[model samples]
Target chain A: MKKIGVLVGVCLSALLLASCGTSGSTSSSGSKAKGSYQTTGTANSGEYKGIITNGRYRTSKSRGVGVSQNTENMLNLKSFESGLTTISKDHFSPKSYVFQEGQILSKGTVENWLGRKSKDNPEGLNPKDNGKKDANKRNPIYVQQIEEQDYMKEENGKLHLAGITIGIGMNRKDYYQKEEYGATYTTDIPKEQMIAEGKKAAAKVLARLRSYNAVGSSMPIVIAMYQQAPNDSLVGGTFYATTVSNSGTQMGTWKATDLKNYVFPVTDTDTVPSKNDADSFDNFKNKIQNFFPNLAGVTAQAQYDGDSLQGLNVTITTQFYSETEITSFTQYVAKAAQTYLPSGIKVDIQIQGSDGSVQSFVARDNGDKGFYTHVFSSY
Target chain B: MKKIGVLVGVCLSALLLASCGTSGSTSSSGSKAKGSYQTTGTANSGEYKGIITNGRYRTSKSRGVGVSQNTENMLNLKSFESGLTTISKDHFSPKSYVFQEGQILSKGTVENWLGRKSKDNPEGLNPKDNGKKDANKRNPIYVQQIEEQDYMKEENGKLHLAGITIGIGMNRKDYYQKEEYGATYTTDIPKEQMIAEGKKAAAKVLARLRSYNAVGSSMPIVIAMYQQAPNDSLVGGTFYATTVSNSGTQMGTWKATDLKNYVFPVTDTDTVPSKNDADSFDNFKNKIQNFFPNLAGVTAQAQYDGDSLQGLNVTITTQFYSETEITSFTQYVAKAAQTYLPSGIKVDIQIQGSDGSVQSFVARDNGDKGFYTHVFSSY
Candidate 1:
């Protein structure tokens, strides 16, 4: 009995040592297991168990020892409001916040008790909550400071922004500090949800601008939502959605007036349509090839409004076997272009000789059921 | 004595097993030990212990069982000549080789026995050796073949080759084939040595091209040598040397006539001078700043011919504190530009108001000296 007891004790000691080794390995590896967000109700409820503090929401679980406390212990609504006030004092002008479409909030309105401190009182105690209040008498609009950046694409000396990205948090370093937030990080939100939120925010901003009558009505705007992550940088971010809106005109600043023009250079290789409109232009060129068997090669330049075809300029080089056939070839191409091309597109055709001389013709849509008519042609 | 003998036998068996295991490990690991090149004489002699065959030299030592045999066994001069002939037949036109200054070689010079089979007779068996030579009687110029490709740099819609690249040997796949020559890859050649060889080759080619009177005298040509590597591709290569040569006109075609033009748009940010001639333009801008204390910002568009400054267009935006100060400021800037700028460089200055109206002035070189004379002033 004594020997058996001694063996059992030795086995138990070894098991304890193994358990301790496993726990030590976990901490030394620095691999923090990611925590999953749990929905309180429906899967797509968009609400999680967290409290919004310091411009971001924090969950209730403790990340690890010496890292972070539970959310309930650290969160303070009054302190958060005070921090916001301090930030606003440093970065924004007094009365900068717009309320009720076009009215600027008076100084000290945000500091007063009227601004809701928690979700319990979404709207502060105001007589105007009855929905009959005048636009001038509403509470100040409160937001967690908006950050905007232009996303530009430049080609051939033309610079334009496709959209504007708006971030909803402070700079990356401040948001990513492990001492403050522990292992907490932002994740990607659904695009449609972000778009809906961006639209709501943009509507308020536009209404305020309209009340002040500051900007032109025809100006275009793009509101994109960026969920701030720990790794966000100045030039890039995790974007959720981009929504384009116009103030008054349907064709706003983003709409380019005409397609960009290009000129194809002469080369020894067989010429083809530019890659920008290869499908439609190649089909047209092939049809013309069926008409003129003496054609050696074809080169084309085109203009487009976005991706839609606007106009085409084509040059055809021939073997120059027969001078008499040149007139018939030009006529045939002009007719073929008129027959094949879509309505409202302008076509310019040029037949190039072996010696580099070019004969030019222009084909235009007649607006008579997609039939094309030729303008003056020079041979 | 019997026990001792048995012990010795057991130890020998263990030793044999260990040796076999080591050999198995070497083969299984696929570890190839690199071998050093054997020099024939002094390090700089450019000769190695190898045999020249198939247009490439090969070493004597075997690379490994599955790798390749040494260079001596794989190299064959006749096979190399045949390969060249085959490549020429497929890719080159008849009479493509240039023999004498401007003379194209007739069809079968490469295959004829009179042509030198080795480097000992570089020009082959000439009639001069027999003392019956005539300049007119010599066969038309012949070369194995000459190939040319453009090395292009594309920017801002303009595509140009600063130099022309000439490659020796067949394409990459043919050169790198393991079946033809085991372990005979191009990586063994050092980059600097290849560059030196390419420079020498380019100089010879340029001299030969200059001897030919067929091309325009003023044409500028860049001859860059490319040592064909086993991994040669369209987008990238291991370049050796690039040398520029001018034809009869010393000025050469490479000298661009006009400064590349640029346009700068007004923006809220402070504008700097364009990258072309930034130093001189910035100096002139600083001097103008000394004259105008209320200047808000300055944006400049300038033109340059290579590194030389040609013309400058500057737009200055300033606070409209006083109308009288504006005229004096314009005069000061115009005078400063004339004094600071180099002769023959045109300077156009424009002062813009907050509302976008501009006052213009033109500063021209007087030509008598460095003095700049203002042609016109508009407010």
Candidate 2:
């Protein structure tokens, strides 16, 4: 009986050790089980599971870690190559979330892969967590930001190729038309559908634009703009990229130099979001992340590297408003050109007031870096 | 003696008949043993021999004699598939043309295509010469009438997939400063070379544009513009096209209501034997034929057809002024457009004065019941 008891104890200890080894390394093949999303609305709902390899980092919170994680944990950063973990369109473009994985990831055993880590150990594993609570677990804060600048140098900067657009609006048209005092005609699709189409269109346009290299310094690209109304009458809005030029043949401003430059209230009116309504910054970031995760890095603390260019101009526009009631609006559209924006370039921003007055802001200093100069009075 | 004389006469008659038969049917091959071209600026050159599976036509005096030709003459009408003959640049895109042996070209040959006539005969070899003659052995006026129409359609209407920009300029430093001093910089390349490049760029751009379908009735297109000198410089022009739009919250000119109300130029430009440079036009046309010989018709009445289109807008700009002097200048840019433009479409010509004032003329009707409107002088 004594001998039997000793054998049983030894077997239990060995099993425990094996289980612990499985959850320690992220780069191990099948090391992290795939993750799934259970979503509502336009989002997809299902459980996902996958393994990470080649320098992938993972967090138990970002994806459901398998019950098999050991004392140390690994994270999945495999999205850099094989693409990213995408959620169906439950959220609109420009969305954000504090991602969490419900459990430890399960990576299948690869003795050879794990054997290359440390002096005392052969298995390559992520360093152990500094004895902190596992709530934040392996999840790292991913900062994402986006900006609009010039057209030519934007592609090389971020090294990212964007081919997706996500947005949300009223999926219903009756309510939207009613709220807007009966506006009609535009897209052939219904309001909600149109909004969805618009969102998809934007994504498609960007994807295609990224495929080619066009740098016409002659004209500032002009386009049409749209906005969504809240509720069943709408889903999202749609717009087009178009242009009209002056006789002199140079684009003086984004609004166009051939014509007097000014920002005016949107000719058409639509519903205003209630402040009580959920603030949607998180949702926006979430959707955008689906297509362009790196955009969150737009928040850069840039310093002026003193320089002069033989022939160069830097132009960017940003709009920030935190207002509850949007009685009126006007949209200024330009292609996102930050991907290749030169590092040391002068920037000019035109900030407009509700009354159509304009203020030109030139920022060669770090202090002036931020979103567009135009903001609503209430915001 | 009488018997001998009779026998001799009989033999002579027999010999004479035999000689006549030999002269009539010559079943053997002629001296067109091979084909060769002087190596020069013709980017592409070749030799091919095709049969008239159907009745075809030839306009070039050098082509379309009998079926046994083995030289350059036998290669006309593009009867054969691959031996020789320069194909258009369009054949190099994602999609290309596939021709079988014995197929006839509509304009370059005697008949439409082998067997494509009212009668169905794939091997029909009957042809026409029209017997019309000019100093160049082909009617220049007739060719102008036909090719100009085709040039407008394929060159301007098709949707563009993608393209590259040939030239880029951030600012007008050289020409602008010099225009102030009334100095016009002549191009090192002769007028013939400039015209040739312009034509080449046009064909290439057109070929690339044909691969895509219109986007939401907004066909993606590239513009191959001849950026004319501001009466101050002679520089080769550039071409640019777009398959993608800049990522902005706007739509481009497709949204402009002006499309519905817009009218075409009213009159056509005049074309006379240009005084400033008499040989320039013939040389220009010859340069084009060398590259695309099929563009010339068998009757020498060459006409061009837009590859495929419902309606397209074309604006042509040409000058009849010498590089050194501006006298005897007649605007022939939009001349053919007025007489040949189809219905429901607009094509035009614009003339610029020494001081930069402009006048416009509309395309003429194709003589069909359908007529295009000319809104000349409206601008």
Candidate 3:
């Protein structure tokens, strides 16, 4: 009984150290309040215990903390994080598993893996440098970033790392400046090569994770492959494929994700696969343009899986000052959206005045009839 | 009795048209939900009924929508809006007034007001164009943008526009490109002149507001002057002065708001007025840097109201992949912040890994002994 009590104490301390090691002042996790499992202090009243985050945010091991403020990379960053979280839901159900940030992968290990294969860093996953300055000859940095998320489950009143989701962000283009503060040049990587390289990188990451004693061979892992947008693109990239290894060090059979993202009123006809979606968006745009003659521009970004549209994010730029005018215009937009745009897809519309502050927004959930609208007041 | 009823019906229709004309679907304002006055659908349990926005966002009348993605003006944009809002709190208390977007000033009027004063546009507030292409002689568009916010009060079971706050954003430097996709040149405006011009413009704006029947002589107006940061600045501008004119169109006594914003680890000694505050930040930064050897940079944006510091927003850039390291480091940061920084000020610290994603944050309110830290997990 004494030996058993000591072992239990060790496990409990380890759990506490992992969850609240930052300040050690926050409320403890798995402190059952009534019937529900309580975790973080975040207000959550549901069956699924809210994510017990360690307060560590994810950053790309290679990119430094953030890109330049001027870069259009923020869009890609948002998609990469949110899209990975969405993919995590498929394997790690929020109802059964509690979300925790991946704590096992140390900073040193991730940094080494992101670096180009070198003599000193033999574990590097990226292609080795060949001492060539030419864009065509030089190998691009195929694997840009890796993000890991761990799902926890309570067993014997203690949270256990049940499942892990890994997101590998692959670059579609490699940008390099010849000199400091000089003009930037780009080298494009073929889509097929990027996908192939991503899968290989994912497998290597999996193998490395398995080497850790905590993450044994039996641990279930889900690896999602993301193709990042080019540096100049306004919209972000999407996940191309994903694989789920139920219980092994080896990766499972790859499943191609038909997910795609396209800016509406696409300038290039070849970029958009669906002409019907383009036409539908055009109708919506035209309706809005016709209503407001002095509109600066009306643009939308649509996401699709296979042929059907999954979501649409629209931005309308116009000159507005009055409450009555905004209200009347918003009503017109809602009516136009319902009549012209494709239904059965989640849609969000943001109306920004010439000054760029959000004037109003119209949002509709998937399969919803009525649209929800809100106007922001400056006062 | 018949004439009185007709007049009441007209007034009621006008009120409805002003408030809920957008969709006429959401709940009406001043419905009085139990003990509170309900406005929008947003959940608000405070005495303030919340803002009754008309659903129109503010954009720069001159700039047109958002600036280029690469420009560092977003920092300035945030300060201009939030700073103005903060200034408004002094005059328009949430307990008595409901916030609303400006309604009387039409888009055409604002657009015209932002243009250069000429024979065709007599009401233009900006200096008339001299038809000079030379940067030295050309009249700069000193009046960059204008934001108007209305504060409403409940009277006789109806909302009335009682107060108005106008934020006049003046440019410190005017950037002009000779040709499309060409080299950009800047013409700097002297600080003394910018302030003088802003005050002059404020009086003009006041006179215009008085012309409107809804905003007549009795309506109180607060106009705050903002000296915008240059195009290349990492930090934003600050509100230099503000004047509140009560019950008349004439300008009131201008009060110099000594509110200033500065980037810490000061490279230029002349910029920071208080030397002790600078040394305090250095001590705090050094403590964290000494503890962690590998850090990209540690910087803070400190806002000071006169000689006293109001708030500190610090960002620490480093490489982090593990939750344990983040937790440990966050604890150290919290300790360092408490020990080294100013005691009676709100401080927020965000730690970002090399890749640019936030690892964790440590925040402490004024007069608080302990800090609140949150770690965001990928899962």
Candidate 4:
């Protein structure tokens, strides 16, 4: 009996070992987990559970009532708005404002209503106080404008903006047009200003969670910033920035995989002025234009390795009367280009004749008075 | 005891099977046979089973006479001559002749002696009766000449020959000066005539070899004919033709792996007269001298892919007083080259001025009335 017990024990141990090894090896290489939320209570029960969605926090109980799909959607919307408000306040400051998609009490909505007058509503709503009971029944998420802030502007008869973006929950429908989201001013503001505004707006986005007792169930929220095109007819804007709130334990694991930093324009006020090699090459070409009276024009292309000028190739079209003239012209052009081009910039000059003759010269600058030159000709 | 015997038998069978498998697998991958010659008889014995030295047959018998180093050397010399004579007769024919080295009895030797003689021996030795017995004592393999064939000639004071080469056994020292063996006639003789003369001389060489029976053994022989240089001082001649004799069974297998054939001069008598493209280009340049008065010279290089003319590159160095003149000159040259060059030949023309400017044109023949022209220039 003792021997049998020992044998049985060994067999059981082996089976356990085998099972453990198999499970450990298969998990990582197997299927991924589905669904973002963890259910804590029975469906539709008054019992509540805290849920984080899109980085924002909410609860399953809707105002102390049973959880419903509609209440879940509303909580999701509020969570999204809470995340946006955090972003706007923390980052954008004076340059940006946060808004809910359906909140009718927002200043921007009231202004919009006052501005658009129709035949049926000849008396436009007052900007200060529209005083309508129906307003409370309106969607709870709506555009909000900060004090003394105008979200839209016109300049030079063209509409422009810093940028705008909008995102809907994975399970909900988008209620607004793509253009109604993130936007910038219409004026030709400096790139530096625009980039500053964009960065400020990005910083205001909160990577946190918020739960309103007025709403039900925990909800997840994701906020994305879309960049607006200077001209809508040109190209549709793209999502440029993103942040999440109410992710709870998944907060550390949830990665904002795609984000782009705004670029500023180079202005005279900047610390360093831009130097273009192509512009310099064009200037050099102009200097040599008069040297060949018979030449029609001179064109040049400059090559660069990063910001350092590597080489310049120039071509001129002209007519040659004799071999002597061709030689003289080639020498003259070579000398002129050598003198006109910047030091250490290698230049190649090619001249083509109307009668189908070509002469080419390469002048390499060694940072000295004279240039090392090589000439090639096609006869 | 029976059980033990059965176990032992089984073990023995397994061992046998393993050994057989190993042996069968190893034989194919084993080392290869070494050395070039097959060993027949015991070494250093007067009784030799046939041995092949340098691809030639030899036996242990040393002529049955006392072995002397001088006799051996003479035999070796004789064998070499036999090879040459065979080659001359079998290949060169009436166009060639063979003369034993230092053998004044041979017509070609006597003539050479006479030709080199000054005021004292100007009459030269008689071809049949040059009684100077010392001539025979001279190295028997001294120098052989094929006759009626002045292998070398002076043309306009320049020594010239067609070209020729000869390679002897690996270990033997070359007895004759390189120039003495292969020669070309100075005069412009038809290739066919020279070949005929060489053949005849070769036949005579064979006849002379049969007279020397002192060697008392048949020998394998290889003969090589080297073409002579047009001007011996200008360039060394190259190998031209070859033949063999007394090679026996080995003749078919013994290939002249290094033999090079003579390139017959292209002459007017041939079915297809040779046209020197360089000369043609020079002639064309001369014809267009008047068109570019300021030009120094027009040089051209022609390229051929095998026998097919491919292209010509021409360069003209000159001076041009005005652009108009340059254009006209370029156009004139392009048109002239297009008309002068052979059909399907592409021509590139470049004109360079004294002052260093250059004009180039490419005219490709399209098998039409005009050429497809392109112009390149440097101004």
What DockQ does each listed candidate score? Answer: 0.01, 0.00, 0.04, 0.01
lDDT of 3 by residue, A199-307 (tens): 8899889888888888898889999998888866767788989998876666789999977888888876456867767866776676566443365478887888878
Stretches > 4 Å off in candidate 4: A1-379, B1-273, B276-283, B305-307, B355-357, B363-379
Please compute the TM-score of chain B alone for each predicted structure, in the order given.
0.27, 0.19, 0.81, 0.27
Reference-based TM-score of each model: 0.21, 0.14, 0.50, 0.20
TM-score of chain A of each: 0.27, 0.19, 0.82, 0.26
Residue-wise C-alpha lDDT for candidate 1, range A1-379, written one tens digit per residue: 9999999998997796566445533332111223221111111111111111221112211112101211222112111212222222222222221101101222232222223344554433212232322333332222222333222223443333322222232112211122454564332334454444444554554443334333446334444333332232111122333344555423222211222333343234633334424544554566545433344466665544445655555667664322213433444454445434444665556566555444323334323343221111110
Better of 3 and 4 by TM-score: 3
DockQ result, candidate 4 = 0.01
Cα lDDT of all candidates, in order? Answer: 0.34, 0.22, 0.69, 0.34
Docking quality level of the chain pair in candidate 1: incorrect
Q: Estimate the TM-score for candidate 1.
A: 0.21
Question: Which stretches in model 3 have alpha-carbon errors above 4 Å?
Answer: A1-379, B1-49, B52-72, B268-270, B289-294, B323-332, B353-355, B366-369
Chain A, model 3: TM:
0.82
Candidate 2 overall lDDT versus native: 0.22
> In model 2, what is the error at residue B143, expressed in angstroms?
31
Clashes of 1: 12
Query: Which digits, one per residue and each the tens of the lDDT, describe model 4 over residues B270-375?
Result: 2212254443454456544544333356665443434555555566776543222343344445545543545465555667666454543444532444543322
How does residue A106 of candidate 4 score in lDDT?
37
